[model samples]
Target: MDTCCAKALVTGKVQGVGFRRAAQEQALKAGITGHAINLADGRVEVLMCGERTAVKRLAEWLRTGPGAARVTHVEFEVIEAHAPDDFHTG
Candidate 1:
């Protein structure tokens, strides 16, 4: 049960479509903690921290967000950060 962190930038019809909320739901389900925020460049930035498998799953899910989202691309990268106690959107 290795723990890790991953940051992903999701583009295309992501914002204003409940992407962050959906991500939070998925993160909770996976026992992950972090945040999903809307970037000024019209992308959704998702930060996931938890088990390696859960992080990977959340990252993969970002590729095809909620039904309202039209994800065109996702840029993922592992990083170092202090994880929060629960998932959030900002």
Candidate 2:
């Protein structure tokens, strides 16, 4: 149960499409913590911290996003874990 963090940039039809909210919900369901925010460059930034498996699952989900999201690409980097109390949308 190694804990870890992931920073992901999700692109394509992500803004104004419930992507952040959906990401929050998914993170909660996966028992992960962090935030999802819309970037100015038409991308969504997601930071997730949790068990390695859960974080990986969340990253996989980011590739598809909510049904309305076009999700052209998802780029991610492994980071030091932050262990936030809850998931949020920004």
Candidate 3:
């Protein structure tokens, strides 16, 4: 399983919607490392690195967000892998 890294910015109805927790769960399930944080501007930022397939699956899940989330946009970019120590919510 090849590895890949990505930095994603999710916007629209993201904050205060359990988005961070969902991200943490997904990352953990996928054996990925990174953190999800809510920015002051009401957007969510996620930095994740893991097996390519796992990360891609996680990214797809992020597109829809959690059951309570109203995701409107997800902007993501793939980058060089910098495997982090763990997955967390910030």
TM-score of each: 0.87, 0.87, 0.87
lDDT tens readout by residue for model 2, 1-90: 789988999989999999999999999999999999989999999999998999988898898988999999989999965556897899
Clashing pairs in 1: none
Per-model C-alpha lDDT, please? 0.93, 0.92, 0.91
lDDT of 1 at 71: 100
lDDT of 3 at 46: 95
Model 3 agreement with the true structure over 1-90: per-residue lDDT tens digits: 689999899998899889999999999988999999999999999998989999999899989999999889999999886557897898
The stretch of ten residues in a row with the least summed lDDT in candidate 1 is: 78-87
Flag regions of model 1 displaced more than 4 Å.
Answer: 81-90
Model 2 compared with the native: what TM-score? 0.87
Q: What is the lDDT of residue 56 in candidate 2?
A: 88
Candidate 3: lDDT over CA atoms? 0.91
Cα error of candidate 1 at position 66, Å:
0.3
